[model samples]
Target: MRFTFMCKKDMVPIAGPHGRGKIAIVGAGPAGLAASGYLVCQGYEVDVYDKLPLPGGLMSFAIPSFRISINSIIEGVEDLRDNFSVKFILNTKVFKRDTVRRDEGDEFTKNTVDLRELLNNYDAILIATGTWKSRKMNIPGEDSKGVYTALEYLFLLKSYELGYLNHEPPKANKVIVVGGGLSAIDAAEVMIHRGADEVYLVYRRTINEAPAGSFEINRLRRLGVKWMELAAPKRIIADATGNVKEVELIKMKLGEPDESGRPRPIPIEGSEFTIEADMVIEAVGEIATSPFPDQEYLGIKQDRRGRIIVNDELRTGNEKVFAAGDVVSGPSKVGRAIFLGLNAARNIHLYLTTKRISKGGT
Candidate 1:
């Protein structure tokens, strides 16, 4: 649980005026931070930009601090800053045009820097901007006042906990979390922590197929959380004031495997149920958010799912641009993001040293 960046004690620092070409990292999350560590050790002038005021990304803002030590993340970041001379541009969003979608960490963004600006200035640009947009259920009354995405709810609470917000997030007595992912588990735990009397976790699939796995679900069950599998929320029932009062759910049965190779949950007709809920937290999933909109900006192509297209070297269509982490691989665990980041950094180092763009970068 002791999370810290790799030490660069023996490695010579190559920063300052005579260092290698500057590298601009678009995110300060695990991937971006990992790449910054490697690039800095290699003597590249590294600058990281993020929308959040802090430098730890989801580790510092969205994910629970207990799960990831905030002090450890901050310490590693401070080491990069003080020893490696890595520059962090906080509270700034790097995007192209006004088409960038508003995500969880945008609250503290006081300034915006064009993506083209970085492309023009830095020798290489690494886009590690992790997924920030939460996927919606698109059900009726989802826009209700008491309904919130897991990312938004967690971010709001974390901002308050970190003193970025003066007030606390609204509390609920009975909360219902939808989905079977880690986000959903975290949301259910947060509700318990927030003193919710009743916490229900309803998922379309069983715990065996949950993204968070069965152990976590069972652990939450031991903590008094009611786990209801084979159920999907049909809609959020709102009161006259537009506040969430209940959730209508439909029973489901697993059928043939879907595109994800997971058994698709087939809704059973006429098998509906309702759960009283003062608040609803949707943790279905998250969408990868690129700095640019849904277009091939600067020759950087994104899939229909909004994930950036990269070659074997993590190089995008633009020779000078590379991508890694959730932005390129979709939503993933911190370890996976870190691995991709280090890989991208190594490839970038090779490209910079050889002065030859890798073949098939597009």
Candidate 2:
């Protein structure tokens, strides 16, 4: 979607300086970049900060290279950098709310920066940090050495694929992937491509509940990745080396539909079984838990899921702050985040330039 910051002819030049207001955007992913693009177009100086050495967040690490070419992402970022007055602060994390707050003291705190200081320095701030926390199964032996979250495994694989790692690939032969979502399929496919001798996708429900699109599921089957449906992993069995050796599973049957409108899987009595594998990967989902506390602080509010709450204009309760992407909407597709980023950027530009909020706060 196209996003522009041009004002109506009658409402031009009423807010502040033209293209002179400073804006800080957290996270260098699609949302952050998109916001930067629109803000820059409207004459705002934009600086993007990220914890990673590179931009693109999950798009750069979690997604397989085959699905999204690295060159394309680089080109997009480069375009924004060249055309817009955009600065990137990589390898720097905004760990605490104070990091973005205005400083009351001259000295810096450990792993914390003053948010108030940032507010005084910049005209506005945009929070676009995407969800990086992985959800755990809470099952036994989950802490086993060979167990990995989907993002962790994918990040390592993509890093290796991008020449960030020179060592031999991790040993993952006879691997079992838990979950039926797109991430689960991607992890399974990558494991096989990376030389896993056997790959099995274990799902707690039927294929209908799998997160993989039909076309992708068909492709996986064609590629020979085995699917164990109606199976729930109960525990990870490890050997003396603390490496996963087998997984205990319980057979499940479909019951009443759950909140997602999908039939819930009910564990069957005395229907336990075991599958031997060298490694296990969990691809359930991700959560957005800000390093900052959820209570009222700096005029920001968090929803029940711990995502920052924002209005339609992407503004938080605080007038000077805005938010977008996964940090506000929870884990979602990259394209959706980009769309919201653009919208948020435009709204921010409008507010900064006209001093009047538009229909959409963002």
Candidate 3:
């Protein structure tokens, strides 16, 4: 299916007077882009800043174009820039403080902007910096050369495919992806498309309990992607050159429901097995990433898991700042993030018009 943002009837002509106020949105992902569309239509001067070279963020970078057409995103972004006067500051990362913290999609960042500077310059600020850091299994030999996070692997190939990188991404003959999420499915499909002779999708839970659902998993299986259910990686065995050679996996069984309301996988004794692999991708999950290192910065607080804390109105502790999307609710689909972005945009318009903001840090 095609994803068109500006083609929709909601892409209203610029309404209200210009110079309503300057709004700075960090991260040009789904939420940030959606908010920009809304605020720009409302006649606010919107500037979207992202570390990537393109404006669509993950939609244009990490995610494969087959799933989300980059051309559609580019068309929408072009509409915002040409018609509504939205400015996208690409290849620049917004940071609260100068630190060495970097995420998967930050490889192409050429410049940096301080959060404090944006707060002082812009009339309003929105932080929609979605999840960027990939979760690791923390198993032995995980730091091997051939072991990569799903984002890193996908982003590298995507960067090359988009002509941002000159070098080609490495091709693996035998690949193993660990997870049951969409990322895993995407990774498996990519490997298969890249001519990998063997691709395996290993998940800790059964196909029925997978986060990506059985339909996607079964689809991958039919595409010659081996499905290893009720199994989890215990260790990544490396060759003498420190590259991944094989992965030691342990069988698992479903136990009582855990905090996620899904049956937790319990390790089965004496069920360890080793699978040969040229490359291993960890697609377990991702964590919310903000521009700051501190838990609380400028009255914006993040939860223990790194999700930005917000209230019913989607306002941050600072009256002039708001947040939305995966950064606030953790990893979510594009549709959910878009909905949250539009909702936050409405709240922002309400705040800007009335000069009264909701009190929230929850």
Candidate 4:
């Protein structure tokens, strides 16, 4: 049957006569989506599983629409569905290998699949599950009311704003946002747009060292967002009602460079102060949550940061398995993840075709 698609024609020719190969991909973020497109062009059947109700992962759900175009993601997803024939098992999580408890996220997952089952059934498997576990500040009262990880806060707000969620987000007169990443900027802007009387962004390092870069900070400044540099949240103080009443901050001085090549922040003794705050958003970052539970038991290795160990080809210790995007490379921009996904897809194709050719005498 003839087909119509918005994307360009077939990709560069690959070896061997095209044969139908079925593959399973976990997570429908930029990585998974890009992988599916490339694989489909290679004439492979692809099934993508995700916990969220639809595709587009963080780009579609977590990030503020003002910072990205949701419609563009929607269009790209539709093109994949209509033209590439990528099957998305939405609202389903490819559950971890050996875990009693399920991983929870902002979205409600309605179905679950065993990771081991997928490993056994598919011709090849690709894990593109980006870091879903938000990092926290090991400070007192961090668990108090009105405290939110940037991921959860952004997901909740974006979902509500998009009408997928019915409930309104938390109302705050004074919002305090921690960190200096894209997530931090997104949270601060959303708060101001939602009528917060004031929004303050606290960063331990100078603007040049910020993950979001100085441009984003300057943009926020133009919007009346206050930038409080060289300070870190020490503690969150709550009122009788259990809501956030204020935040304790410690002054920081730049020290020697850390692993990220940025100057380390050292707290100055006795240089602490308190500020009135009703909401706090921590955007420190997120860690990768491997879909394969007890990965060590299976002989797979992960770094201290919880990133999967992969070779240049993005293949794990298990030949049948491969990983791509942020899960393997650590947190990065969407464009980079998509490129890595496409590259991983090529490697998977090579592995599959090479095996088939050897078995059939080429």
Candidate 5:
């Protein structure tokens, strides 16, 4: 999404507390960044916290620069951090009432900030934490050394590019990427650019039914990445070193539409096949991660998918707390997330102003 900055002439005054009222926004993705823009423009003290050293969330880290330039994202972030007064607390993840200890293999998390403390310190809170947890395939041998979720694979690749790592890109000559979404495409492209001998994209559906649309699939096809359809991975075959050697897959046929309005793939019995590969990347999708995982501290409501529940004003069950972007709407495009962030900022402004007016304030 193209992020636009508000001109200084169009600025609005903060509603209360001599414009020193504070707002804490969690996550530094498109939604959080956009909200920061609005709140800062409105003269509110805004602080954005992110787990990554850099901002832009998935866009800056996981996604391939070929699809979206890192320069644009960096420029927008700089506009907020430099030109505006949006204070970015980087490499810090806010947890629930009590800190949730960092898990193994979690490279993003460094510092921990308690959610309860944020609640007490800030006038309002915005949880814009986009999905960081990747949905696993849950099949056998998924823990193989050469097997990785698209998020992990892409993050590692980007880490090297960002100079965070001294090592080269993870080595795998034959890379097999699973799923039909943009994540899979990005993984395949990165593997191809990394000089992999062969990179194949396997999906259970045709390009017409892919989540990323037909254009991306066709582009990958044109780039000489092998595209195979109507197949789903069943298991990973690992060697003695626990490195991927091949991936076993089963043919599938489209069945009735599932809850997501997409044709579900029903496996064809006895149609299993295998593809020899040195590495495997699964790009199914991401999972919702709320700062308050226990959900007890804030008493905020959420759907079955773990997405935070919110009203038209983007306010959560706890009136002072609100949620925006993927944490509220689940997985979506950057454009959609940015719009949601802008909406949240506007509603938050109104909410704060109304409270002041009711108390005979400006």
Candidate 6:
């Protein structure tokens, strides 16, 4: 679907807030944007920071533009800028807690403020940093030139489609995608669309155990994307030039159900084979990056999975701090992240303006 682009001046902004209480939101993705939206409604000053030049986080680069229009993302940001007095700081990395703290206090006390400063300066702080660290295959020759994480490949494809990058898509006529999740399907489909002669999806389980939704699976079938079910990649074979040429896979069978009530794959003997492919894309998953390391020192709390622990009200253990989106819920759908962000904004407003917790004891 083609998206119509509107000039910056043409977009409408929310008129409720003119920037009152200071709010620092890390990560300018859907979650951060949503939270900023709600916070502005409550008359809070919001500043959105991101490491990337453009916002939208994973939604802007990790997914295809055909699936989620870049114009729509830009429009969302533009709308926020028009209505709310939210300022965007791009290409800024909040690497240390000190940088956040310093920025919050003096706004210019140091070159970069630390996290402690952020906790102290703003009336409230929200961490919405999305997971960007990709899981490695840990297989031999995975460092080969033609091996790429799903995010890298998708980002390149999106950049090329957006005319930001110059290069032919990797010349892999035959491609094998590792993993059975939604990312696997996305990579496989994109490869086929980009003229890969053949695309194979290698998963370590049957379709039932695959993490992809049924509709996505059906779409793959419709696109003639081949599936090598019950197969796990053991290693990547590389040529002398350090470019991947083939993938070694192990066939497996379902074992007894594990704690998650899902059967695990058990490797089968004498079922090893090699699939020739010019490139391999690993779509395993992503790990979250901890924005607040001294949580205990700062009296902040997080869940076992490293997600910021929040009550029903979306406030973190630190009364002055709030978190939402993937940072608080781990990896999840954009819709859910936005929902949580909006809720957090509302709660923040209640606390700042009304001096009352917005129910559920946030």
CA-only RMSD, every prediction: 1.7, 5.7, 2.2, 4.6, 4.0, 5.6
Per-residue lDDT tens digits for candidate 6, residues 167-253, read: 745757999999877778889988888889889988887888777866777788788888778899988999989988888899999
Output the number of the TM-score-best candidate. 1
User: What are the clashing pairs of model 1?
Assistant: 14-43
Candidate 6 lDDT trough over 10 residues, lowest sum:
101-110
Clashes found in each candidate (C-alpha, N, C closer than 3 A): 1, 16, 0, 1, 0, 20
Ranking of candidates on TM-score, top first: 1, 3, 5, 4, 2, 6
Give me candidate 1's TM-score against the actual structure: 0.96
Candidate maximizing lDDT: 1
Between candidates 3 and 4, which one is better according to TM-score?
3
List candidate 6 segments past 4 Å from native.
1-19, 97-113, 160-169, 292-297, 302-305, 354-362
lDDT of each: 0.88, 0.76, 0.87, 0.82, 0.81, 0.74
Rate residue 23 of model 2 by lDDT: 93
- What are the per-residue Cα lDDT tens digits for candidate 5 across 1-362? 33436436665434333364789999899999999888887778889999888889888888888877888988888777666667889988887635553321247677788877898998888889988888889999999988888988788778778877787557789999999888898999988888899999999987779998888888988988999999999999999988899999999999999988889989999999899999999899887778866544565777767788887778887777778998888878888989899898887788777752221100
Q: Rank by lDDT, descending?
A: 1, 3, 4, 5, 2, 6
Off by over 4 Å in 1: 1-8, 12-18, 98-100, 360-362
lDDT winner, 3 or 5: 3
Instruction: Give the range where candidate 1 is weakest over 10 consecutive residues by summed lDDT.
Output: 1-10
Shift in Å, residue 357, candidate 5: 13
Candidate 5: clashing pairs of residues: none
lDDT of 2: 0.76
Our model 5 lands, by Cα RMSD against the true structure, at 4.0
Better of 3 and 6 by TM-score: 3
